[model samples]
Target chain A: GAGVSQTPSNKVTEKGKYVELRCDPISGHTALYWYRQSLGQGPEFLIYFQGTGAADDSGLPNDRFFAVRPEGSVSTLKIQRTERGDSAVYLCASSYTSTGELFFGEGSRLTVL
Target chain B: AQSVTQLDSHVSVSEGTPVLLRCNYSSSYSPSLFWYVQHPNKGLQLLLKYTSAATLVKGINGFEAEFKKSETSFHLTKPSAHMSDAAEYFCVVSLPSGTYKYIFGTGTRLKVLA
Candidate 1:
């Protein structure tokens, strides 16, 4: 079975630019999640989607961060006016259900210079 | 108010020796505890989970963790340390027993000496 997959393994952009990270969850997974990991730190929760709707967005740091999973199979994490502080490895995970065990992607490393 | 704490920042053990990674947690409700491992330049992988169903849980690669409610701990242990086990390990907690939200610990870096 194919596991979760992310796009653009590495990205480098200016501080004021915009970036969108994409994730493709495993087939039949109904719950998707986004997380960010800073260097030398554990992954921090960003948002979660149950089906096509977001189940939890409280972990999003600010309004500049947004995510969507319209069809429930693929998701994208959008960042506006990216700051140097936003540089980190963005991770995506999916589960069969909200409470099911998570399967993770390799991650998209974003660098805001 | 759910949180997980990994007592050690780093641990080192000789190959074929015992391995132990300590973790403590705080939560308002009964929590779901998990251990995840991350190799260099790779994403996190689930090592095992404890959902109160079993105090001792076995996971892939001969890894296991024991949940102790009295000490608020879920420490991971293995009888023999392998070089492949050298990686960053994270302890995570979910509140209300079965929730999607997770609170991750600081993590422990395990090094295997041959």
Candidate 2:
């Protein structure tokens, strides 16, 4: 893909339901990142992947949130039990190097009702 | 620890007037700063970045930012505002530490009046 690609541009789910958001990074990119942006707020870091391993997941808020990049190309963000507060736009970005400029996706707007 | 602060939550400017959006940051080491813009219904776009090599950094859409280490600031400025420039801007800070996580500011909404 010419840019990072995210699946299900919009997702509406009931509270307490499980949901999965996918991200497909640019070709050959070594780093991927996930962020959440609430309405009218800046993006908040969620997790970062260096290759296939999650190098940083400190920003995952709680244990219910998990993300994985098995083959280092596509990644999935899973929320075990969604809450109303989880409603936000989930953004995915990829970079050739960890310190390089990031290319963002259109993002998946999650609405937990 | 690293963090970014956007001084103004909202700024209004008439078209063709100068535009200024203030930002400040705190970092323990030499930091990399960036400015990102978000237009309605669009993905976030990189406006500019300061990587310690230059104090002034130019970006797309005629936007620019200056890195001021002393003041811990990286403020975005445009000589002239355009109606298309009305959008939300965010200031970001990244430390070179092994993690490479970026800290983003709250964001500033720029309103360009015709």
Candidate 3:
């Protein structure tokens, strides 16, 4: 696609199981971000990567949530021992520069049962 | 520390009527502000942005916002509300610059009635 792409549009898993969500950003984008959005709430910043390096991860809720962008193009959000509260839409966005406009993907909706 | 606050959790307006969504921010320095709209099951799209330039910033879809330094406010407004305008709006604040960190408000759900 011409824009950011996310895999597994919807995923449902049992509680305590681990899940991994993938995101493919636009070509040549150096900045990528991850956010989690619950019902009736705005997206909360989780992590940000600047060319394969996590510049800031202050928004990550806890150690249970982690994200990696090895090549700086595709990033994956990993959640361990997923709890019911982990259910939400995981959004990914990218930009050519750190301060440029952002382009977001449709987001991967994860449901922890 | 910096943060953005959305005044209304939800705003309802009649078709063709004027619409307003209030947003406020707290920053130690002059921060960059933005308003983004998210339709049902869609990604957020930027409506407008204020980067210490013009106070009144015009954006797509006939939406605009004013950046007030003294009041520390950035409110989104539209002259006429359309039914299709019903969506969730988010106010974001990015401090300093050269970073992807953004503080997002709780968001405001706009309901346009016909």
Per-candidate TM-score against the hidden true structure: 0.98, 0.96, 0.96
Q: RMSD of model 1, in Å?
A: 0.8
Give the backbone clash total of model 3: 0
**On residues B1-114, what C-alpha lDDT tens digit does candidate 3 reach at each position?**
888999999999999999999999998988999999999988889898888888999999999999999999999999999999999999999887435678789999999998
lDDT for each residue of candidate 1 in B1-114, tens digit (9 for 90 to 100): 778899999999999999999999987789999999999888789999999897999999999999999899999999999999999999999887888987788899999999
TM-score of 3: 0.96
Q: For the second chain of model 3, what is the TM-score against the true structure's chain B? A: 0.97
Question: What are the clashing pairs of model 1?
Answer: none
Q: Candidate 3 at A9: error in angstroms?
A: 1.2
Better by DockQ, candidate 3 or 1? 1
In model 2, the number of clashes is 0
Q: Model 3: what is its DockQ?
A: 0.75
TM-score of chain A of each: 0.98, 0.98, 0.98
Model 3 C-alpha lDDT per residue in residues A22-113, reported as the tens digit of each score: 99999999999999999888889899899999999988999999999998899999999999999999999999999998899999999999
lDDT per residue, candidate 1, A55-75, as tens digits?
Answer: 889999999999999998899
CAPRI-style grade of the A/B interface in model 3:
medium
Off by over 4 Å in 2: B97-99
